[model samples]
Target: MKQAKTPFQFMAASTLTRICGVQATNISELLEQLRRVSTDSVFNHTFQSLSAYHFLTEGFSNDFAQWALAACNAPQMAEQLAALDIRQYESVEDLRADLVQTLESFVAAEPQRAQQKAFEPFYFCEAVTVTVPTDWRAHNLREFCEALWHVSVHSIHYHFVSARLRGPQTNDFSAWMEHSLGLPELADRVEHIDIYTNTLERVRQLILDECIPWVES
Candidate 1:
């Protein structure tokens, strides 16, 4: 039987196809990849794997940032949530090397701004969570998993708002973005994503306001 795909799945698949030219079949494959690989590996492998996809879809000169954001399963991929499945990467070592190289290039390309952004908490968390070993820091599998969870949430909210706010509804790329963010049309714009943003805001408030503070206090 051909199972019906969810909104999130469809968006992610469309985003991948539009940006990378490779049809990932479903978001489940992407999520499974997220679960099984190390953070660094996932981040790096994503670029390496999708570069070919993008080359075929959009010419080489086109910016790859949006594709990266899309592949990261940003808010635009919301409805696609499915049961997480497990898969394995062939080379952890290679993944790490590629991520480090990518970071280096990013820094060299844009040193001042990149460094400033790197100092921010969320980016710091991302660096630590994804590229821990490069920093000569070691985290157990459980810690790494927790880090991936945090990064995934942050990345989704970031891209959904940023990307969806810019494009046309008819475009395959921009369609689900609005639904994912649940934004009210142009009249009322969200001021802050982490705090006053849709479901994420409620989630953050719950975790910070009720849960963490209560536990800490």
Candidate 2:
């Protein structure tokens, strides 16, 4: 088995949620707040939402989509928001721009929807993440798979979904696999896991499944 050129240190993370003191009761308010809110806030609502509600079996994948449907009674707008493919965005600013544009288009088409009151106000929030090193470090593919099985789902989210905004690589695991282990095909498979469709636990399992054959080979 090929050993990694550099050992991959496993990491675990936890998020501290904070209210940014911005609230939106309707689409118009949401659009205005979204334009001015910090990138962290935009990230929290979209990317972080995957981990925050990882166990969700149904409903929209993002907070904005859920709020648009449940609170604002705008299913069409909700669908549009939910349809955003977060993987396409390399930065939070791009994600925020797309979010704003989606709402802008919706509001323009149905101006009455802008004034519609939500059942509960949408409070903009941001996540303060604290990532710490774990004792589980992998020098090879087999060790990596074993350590991955033992890490918390939060760790999976941190390395997989959240890492997209932090660097040029697709994710921590894929990058290490391709660059450190010289396994581009396996890395690409790991990177292609559809985060939007699967729960975090499911994501962890899928990653493990992908690594199994490579480990045995």
Candidate 3:
């Protein structure tokens, strides 16, 4: 295996979730808060919630959609919110705008639904992420696969899911593979792993399933 020009450094992150002092009891209030809340709050509820709710085989993958169904008694709105593909968004602002628009459109069509109060208020929150470099560094494909097996699920989420919001590339692993190792085909495969549907551990397994064969070849 050829050594990478720039070695891939494995990193892990721990999230500290804090209440943002914003709460919404209905669709209208939720839309208001969505517009004003920080990008971290939007990212926390949508992208970060995926890891927390990864075992979900049905329904929505995000907190807003889940809340809309369970709390607000709005199944159609829930479907609309859940239908948002997070991958299409490059920034949390765009995601937030879409979220706001989804709710606005839904309310406009069914005006009565906006005032329907939830069983419990949806409290806005933000993630305070602290990332640290791990000891594992991979200079080649084989070492990269080895590191993948041992790194924590947090590392997988940090490098794969959360990385989308941080850079131009889809994820850290694909960027390194394509740019540093010159394996664009493999990089494309790794970049397509669905984070919304699988657990972090499952995501790790999927990445390994893609890379291990290449390493062995």
Which of the numbered candidates is closest to the native, going by highest TM-score? 2
lDDT of candidate 1 over 1-217, digit per residue (tens): 1111223221111122212222222233333333444543443333322322321433221112332234432222221111111111234344444434444444456445333321112111011222111211112222222332344333333223223322432221123223432322311222222222224334333333322222233
TM-score of every candidate? 0.20, 0.97, 0.95
Which ranges in model 2 have alpha carbons more than 4 Å from their true place?
Answer: none
> CA lDDT of 162 in candidate 3?
71
Candidate 3 C-alpha lDDT tens digits along 1-217: 8899999999978788999999999999999889999998998999888766656656787999999999998988899899888877778998999999999998788778798888999999998888899999999999999999999887887788777788755788999999999999999999988877777788889999999888888
Which should have the higher lDDT, number 1 or number 2?
2
| Model 1 regions lying over 4 Å from their true place | 1-56, 59-90, 116-217
Candidate 3, lDDT over the whole model:
0.88
What's the number of clashes in each of the models? 5, 0, 0
- Listing every candidate in turn, what is its Cα RMSD in Å to the true structure after a full C-alpha superposition? 19.9, 1.1, 1.3
User: What is residue 83's positional error in candidate 1, in angstroms?
Assistant: 31
Q: Mind giving the per-residue lDDT tens digits that candidate 2 earns over 100-173?
A: 99999988988887978889999999988788999999999999999999998889888888787887559999
- Model 2 lDDT on a 0 to 1 scale: 0.90
Which lDDT value does model 2 have at 60? 93
lDDT value for model 1: 0.28
